[model samples]
Target: MQAQQFEKLSLLVDDQLDKPQSVQLLKSVRHDPALQAKLQRYALISQALKGEQAAVADLDFADKVKQQLKSEPVYLMQRKKSDDQFKKTSLAVAASLLLAVVGFYAGKMHNQVQTLAQATTTAAAEQSPAEQMNAQFKEYLQAHDNVWYVNNNAGVKSYARLASYQSR
Candidate 1:
């Protein structure tokens, strides 16, 4: 058969063709013995491809498995559906409760941090300029308190020079 006819036969086997296309192909296949044989071959190929993937491993594969099962002890464990359902429900409830608790604590912590920040800002706003300058100077001194103890010998000299310049 020609490639186009073979392709049409494959499409018919797969039911990929539209109603009109399928109807026309079916009519042509019904009239021609060659088309009929080609259609059957295509169908067999498609069935084999699908079946091989789904169930069939090789010749006598199922028979071998059946023989093996017959020789082995059979396991017949009964499942308790109630136990499984309860476990699933309990796990879901516990997870939701945990999430709620975490969310509540996070919101509480965030509020506490915001309130503390706001109080500090308010206090800073109340401070006079001189007071603010003194606070800044104290913070600077605390930050650089360890600078004079640096490994380099120039650290003390550098700090003294800076202090002198500031005083001047």
Candidate 2:
């Protein structure tokens, strides 16, 4: 009754259905006049198609079609070349941008280093040799204090005692 049953009838006429399915379909067709008529139509169509052939007079039809295809303009090929060139140009631009960023950072770091060096030289020139030595010893003691707290060892305790004596 459904469209699928009609399709099954067509397949049955073509002998394409399995034996059990074919026998079942034949039993249904025997009882149903409409199914028999549909099956007859499918068989006629199959016979007509089997008798049909290409109307071309010459055997060179395939060669002619091949020649026509060869002569046709392939726009996809041109577009692909353009796309490749665009990708290359984009890659070059990206590389240039990356290099510029790296160069800028490198230049900034160099300037910072130079500024620190100038500051150190100016500070050294303003202080006496004894004052500079005292300042250096104080800085060393401060750093040693941090290490003493972290280590909490007997050697660190002795070093801390000596540092306190020197600071006093």
lDDT of each: 0.79, 0.78
Pairs clashing in candidate 1? none
Off by over 4 Å in 1: 1-80, 146-168
* lDDT for each residue of candidate 1 in 14-65, tens digit (9 for 90 to 100): 8888899889888888778787777767777888888853333443476799
- Clash count per candidate: 0, 0
Which is the leading candidate under lDDT? 1
- Which 10-residue window in model 2 sums to the lowest lDDT? 52-61
Please provide, for model 2 over 7-113, each residue's C-alpha lDDT reduced to its tens digit, 9 standing for 90 to 100: 89878767788999998888998888778677767777777788953332343466799999999997754433678888999999999999999999999999999
What value of lDDT does candidate 1 attain over all alpha carbons?
0.79
Best by TM-score: 1
